[model samples]
Target: MSTGLGWRDGRAVLSAVHGRRVHEREVVPGVEVGWLLGGPRRCIGAWLEGQDERTPCPHHAVIAADGAAVQCASCQSVDRGLALARDQILDDGRTYRLYLAWFGEGLLKVGLTAEQRGTSRLLEQGALAWTFAARGALPAVRRAELTVAASGLARERFKSRVKPDHWWEHGDVDHRRALLTDARVRAHELLRGHGVELLADHPVTDHVGVFGLTDGAPDVYRAVEALADGAVLAGRLRPPIGRHLLLDQPDDGTPLLLDTRLLTGWTLAPAAGRPSAGLALSERVRPAEPDTQEALF
Candidate 1:
């Protein structure tokens, strides 16, 4: 069985695959979210939202550990062909909204989503704060995204690997909101020439609290950059950031971050207990270097 993590409606969900069948479970806070990896990474299979529920790969494809995509060649064509594409030209007449999502300081990006989805996209991307810039047909709203991206008002893409370093900023939400506000203002100004209907009076929505970051980041924590077979991850899960799970074990004083992307391609078994080996973790968060320590000290 292959089990993976995902976000739905501002909550964490665990989906498992056995043969061709898929099952889902909601992962709530204060619950010990535990799982043991079965073996090397394999293709998690295809996810075709509008067409069908996810299905196992007909070939049961095996993939590399650090590949850019979790799906194999066949699944990519069928699932990612046009879904969530900004370059596609479609006149299906669905309204779209352009938004600015702040991941951290200097990590703002421009994107568009269906008007009906509201802030779902922002929630799924682990945005700290977000705001809408405009609304219109798909093409027009996408154009707004490109305009802002080209103007350097916001990024067109972001890297997830750097997110954990700033995970401690929950207590400093005022700074996050300020960063989003400035980026949104620049984005709005950049899109003034576009034909889309500009949005106004919409305050930047903050998710630090929603992410269980209101209590502030822990003084120190560990992170998992990748996963291996037999790794055990068990702890009280905080609100996950997209697919990122922050597992805390107060008893041992070790907090860990495991990116669920690594969970995508492998089967997961419930661990009987915290194995002595447990999960391999990266370095701990170090305190800020004492202001570069001048010669006079």
Candidate 2:
């Protein structure tokens, strides 16, 4: 199998699968990988080395259900320093755009990204709806992000759990559109008040169809808990929602919400039986259980 994982365009893909076959060129659509047999073999400490480099250190580390990768102790110290100096390290001479992304209901976040990447950033973030509020040089965009945060209009990140269940079940489209429009209006006014150039003409992105929730869309999975190391996940994959991959399990017919990040730094092999033997999707997969002695204390 391939040695590592990487993000292309706006999708999480496997670099290699059984037999050292490399998926270098094609974006292994979430649906494709979800249908395969295999699961996380082990967790490894991984971190981004540069703006475009992902380095997987061979150290056993804890992987979160939400797909957050935690590096080992030594790596964590280095990562902390890198994060503190991120502004200096990532300062390539490029324009950045400020955006307002809506997840669901009242969940929204304001963030900045390189102008040229466009909506790919939003797609990677799994935003249900988003609109550009302002565009400027890096410093100006950063200032606007801080201004928006200070005003309590939005933050830098929003959790995916805030999203409504079965997003397309009701009049979600129209209601979501209304919410985005209002958010956009408020964002524009706030940016303009802070002297940031308003981007009133940018189109709003609606990702209902992108996640395959549109009419006649294919079946997808919804995971309840995280996958443990050595747990084999076998199912048909659907387009991801945020960093989550929806898998349709063959045996129990249950949907699973898998964090794509868990796939990084893993070496996967095809499992032996149908339904991958003991690969049952259950809510029991948790980060860790509390100790009985600790509770008593």
State residue 170's C-alpha deviation in candidate 2, in Å: 7.0
In the range 1-297, model 1's lDDT, one tens digit per residue, is 554676667666778777767788887777876777767687766667554567677777888765546777787666643455735446557899888888776677888888877677788778878888889998788778888898877887788886666666543767776777777777778878788998866788888888877765677777776677777767887777777777887577678877777777877777755742445577666457566558666
Sliding window of 10 residues with minimal summed lDDT for model 1: 80-89
Alpha-carbon deviation at 6 in model 1, angstroms: 2.6
Candidate 1, residue 70: Cα displacement in angstroms equals 1.4
Q: How far in Å is the alpha carbon of 220 misplaced in model 2?
A: 11
RMSD in angstroms, candidate 1? 2.8
Q: TM-score: which candidate is best?
A: 1
Q: Give the Cα lDDT of each candidate.
A: 0.74, 0.59
Query: lDDT by residue for model 2 over 1-297, one digit each (tens)?
Result: 233333456565455433323355334444434323233343443345443433444464544433455345556555523453365434456677889887755567898877787667787777777888888777778888888888888887765554534343423667767776787787777777564678877777788777666642223334444444555666666666665666666765656666555555455555534363333344422223357887776
CA RMSD, predictions in order: 2.8, 8.9
